[model samples]
Target: MSASTPIARSKSAALARILDNVPKGYHRYTCGTVAARKAEALAQKFHTLYGIGCSPAQRLIRKGKGLANVVLVMHWPVDAEKVEWLLLATDGKGLETETLRDVGDKQRLKWLGYELARHTNRAKVMWTWRRTKEEMTELHALIAMQANQHNTAAISETLERIARQPGFRGVRTQSWALCEAALQRGYDGPLPHLYFVQKTNHGERLALD
Candidate 1:
């Protein structure tokens, strides 16, 4: 089914809801101050990586078996209407940057294989002896280019830029720049020097820098 369809949207939303509650000790990647559209985009990414059919019980089984990594996309309420703090949950044992890279790579390879097999060698009849390998080599380069766009540095820069956009407010935290602002309401410790931008002087703000 197309991702744009209503049923597909519902399934994606359902999958995201299930992920809201996950096993303890999962790592978090916070994409702070997410609008509904951006949250949906992130949820679609998770849905693409892990199929929407996964259940909490099955997630536990997969984690136990070491056959699959548990992943979740979650959002918490923000003062702004129709926006939230989007966070990603994954196996906490590894670095968050590496986990994101690994997930992106696996998805790319899976799509590449499917496309090469489907387009160049339909019916599995081996239309050409070496066509599949040749196509794969060509496609791999394109995948590499796409992969570069999502590296740690690039993604961090993107998130930083997003944080500075109008409407986001609150003080930055020590753990990570994006998450601290979101968690400041409950955090009792000292806050950092960064803060998000507000377009106008009309809204309920957690704090001002």
Candidate 2:
């Protein structure tokens, strides 16, 4: 087929749009349709490239496809946050990593007709199926805090950033709503900046690094 063919041009345009949708500057797990390969084959690819026991987990990517879901071609070991942080801290576009940053070799090969192993710094699955009120409340807090992170720069800028994040519109929470209201009103009192407020043991003293 010639490069100028209609199908070729259409594919090129579609691929370009996919790349554009990808968050820039962050390392991405190049995902493919779940029907593309067997679990063993997918895991083997990562093992071959990264090292022994370096199996990547499958991630469901929900976007663009009307009723269809997508899964990873071969998940990369590093998560977007780790990649961004490593790049920023090292001041380089790429960074090195030791083998299996999180676990040993793949085990329990299969209990469900598939083996999905991952030792990546990937975030917890979003499980966008649904959320309870409490879960939604937590999401709002997380959103507000994420917006105010140093990476976010300013409040107004963070608001804009929050607006751009997907899967948040469905969440409804009074606390998050309050935070949003305060943020919109320019009331920047105290923000929920900590990821988890660790509760120390009763007799244990907190240690400062």
Candidate 3:
């Protein structure tokens, strides 16, 4: 047998073992449909990559398809305060225009991803193209502050910088409702999972793979 075959089998067996030992009375949360599907996909990826089961206990909760929301019940401990702190920290800084201009570079993406991963244990991230113009501007300023303390550029400088970037130049408003949603629940991280989702949609999932 090939070396990978045994490793794959071992991972599958470990998942089975984890499922068999699921605990009783696990609480389920409505994470929305897209979030739920994405979460499951992430869980599967984690199993394949690390052979780690997401939950130690299983509880049969309602399962629905074609629904806009996906729900899950996990038995792991959640640190709400920690999540909030992380989210606030991430939202406080916006990427510099120079950084955004270089976003097309492979090295930059990897560097940013590495920086983000150090703050959380999550393996994937998602990015949504759904922010209003005002919201996007505010987010950019916040990210800028987080990225640098001496970015004393005037509004015109910032606007000019943003205007020079091709992808974001015309996107006067980008949707950040997802970020707001995550913040509502006190989640904090650099949104690596959102980045993963964007790459997936662009057929660049292989980059992450």
For TM-score, the strongest prediction is 1
Cα lDDT of model 2 by residue, 21-129, tens digit: 2222122223232222243344344334322131122111211222111211221221211110001010121224421121112331111112223222266321111
Alpha-carbon lDDT of model 3:
0.25
Candidate number achieving the greatest lDDT relative to the actual structure: 1
Query: Model 3, which residues run further than 4 Å from truth?
Result: 1-81, 84-128, 132-153, 160-209
Off by over 4 Å in 1: 1-23, 50-53, 65-82, 88-209
* Candidate models: Cα lDDT each: 0.34, 0.28, 0.25
Better of 2 and 3 by TM-score: 2
Candidate 2's displacement at residue 199, Å, is 42
Model 1 misses residue 132 by how many Å?
A: 57
Q: Which pairs in model 1 have colliding backbones?
A: none
Kindly report which residue stretches of model 2 are placed more than 4 angstroms away from their true locations once superposed: 1-40, 43-153, 168-179, 183-209
Poorest 10 consecutive residues of model 2 by lDDT?
82-91
Q: lDDT per residue, candidate 3, 38-88, as tens digits? A: 433543453344222222221111112211111121211122111100000
How many residue pairs collide in each prediction? 0, 1, 27
